[model samples]
Target: MQKSITNQNQENIKGIIFMVSAVLILPFSDSIAKWLSSSYTTIQIAWLRFLIQAIILIILSFSLKYKITGFHKKFILVSIYISSSIVFLFWGLKYLPLANNIALFFIEPLVLTLLSVLILKEKLQKNHIIAVIIGLIGTLIIIRPNWSAYGMASIFPIVSAIFYALYLITLRQVSTKTNSKSLQFYIGVISTILLSVIIVVCELLNIDSFGFKQIDFNDWWLILLLGVITTIVQLLVSKAFFYSKASSLASFQYLEIISASILGWLIFKHIPDMLTIIGAIIVISSGLYLISHERKNSKT
Candidate 1:
């Protein structure tokens, strides 16, 4: 019994480390996207991000001999949802401050809880309902100030969060059936294909944002860095979920705001206002409350 407890504790620690690392590193990619969005359309940046991801994963698969074979039909849907999540996030970054964008996106865990209740047939406790309400209120607090400057663009991260929550649901279903590396590889492949098609269609329709414009080496390097960051973040998150009960790591996600705020200030000279900071605190608190309650309920 002691040995088992020790092993579980070790796993929990590992999960926390991985999850925190993943969330912290994730903001760097968003910062890069914000940097590049000045010169590229959101769609183009999204495509190149995944294109490079697919390429790296392909090379890694071949070199490591990782026979990645999780090509289930659901992965295609996962691709679509995750693709939308990222594209929407990129769109948000173009208009909103990085810290604010990431803070608003933190609503995802609440969204995920609600989704679990609806789709997974989990019973919705009163606390879950309360959390969602508080989460939405927090979202509004942040949006209220940004509305004048960013208007509808401020909500893009929420849209991104919703699709991302959906992606998480589908991902939860398939995650245990295959290796994380394989799942990530297929997601890259499918997202690359799906985004490519969308970009082509948008280009044909003469959509300005999806046009294939020329980019210099600077853009190329940022895209490369974005791809690497995406890959690393996903792997770290996967390891986190694998090693730890997600509930234990829920609070660590808030660390992202720190990194994002730092990046925003340093790279873009943007900072979240007091209202946005309060809103983020509320949302993060509610999410932590909801997840912790859920974990307690599960234990009981």
Candidate 2:
């Protein structure tokens, strides 16, 4: 019993480390994407991100002898859902401050909680309902709908959150049956293909799609860093889940908001207003409470 408890503690520690590292690195990729969005279209950026990730995944699969199995229709849907979320996030990043974007995107957890209740028929715990309401109120505070300052771009993150929630729900369904490497590779391939088609259609239509921009040597490095960091962070997050329960690791994700805020201030001279800061605090508190509530329920 003592040995089992020690092992679990070790796993939790490792999971915390992995999750913290991933969250810290994630903001850098978002900052890069926001910077690149200035020069490239969202579709173009999404395509490159997935293309690079797919290439690396393919190489890793071969070297590691990871089998590429599972070619279900749900794989395609997951790819599209995730791809759409990325595109919307990049689009919003163009106009929104990084902190604001992160805060709004934080609604994803709440959305996921709601979906679990609705789709999975999980018990609608009272604490969860309260958490969801608090989270939405925090989101509204950041968005400040009365002011209408962010305009249509404000809607992008909300849309992204919805798609992201759907992605998580779908991921839950497919994850049990598929190997993680195989699942990621399939999603990457499908996303790359879908984005490539969008790019081609934009080119053919001669539309004002944020069509591909010329990549200078300097810009090439930034784009490469974006893809590599994203892939690494994702792997770390997966490893974290492997090491510990998802509920135990949930609170660490808010680190991204802090990291994003600091990065935004340093890189773009963007600071969250008083209201935005307050909203972020509220959102984080609600999320933490929800995680604690879930943990307690699991224990019982």
Which stretches in model 2 have alpha-carbon errors above 4 Å?
1-24, 236-255, 291-300
- Residue 185 miss distance in model 1 (angstroms): 0.9
Candidate 2 residue lDDT tens string, 1-300: 767766676766676688778988988999999999888898888889888888888999899887778688898998999899999999999989897887778777677767766775656656656766776677668656632778888789879978977876677667666666777778788999998888878787887665566677778898888889877876776666566544444445655776788899999999778997887787678657755654554344
Summarize candidate 1's per-residue lDDT along 72-135 as a digit string, tens digits.
8888888899899999999999988888788778777677766765675656557656766776
Report the number of the highest-lDDT candidate. 1
Query: What Cα-based lDDT does every candidate model obtain?
Result: 0.78, 0.77
* Each prediction's RMSD to truth: 3.8, 3.7
Estimate TM-scores for all models. Answer: 0.83, 0.83
- Worst lDDT run of 10 residues, candidate 1, spans 244-253
Best by TM-score: 2
Least lDDT summed over 10 consecutive residues: which range in candidate 2? 244-253
In the predicted model 2, the residue pairs found to clash are: 41-210
lDDT of 2 at 111: 71
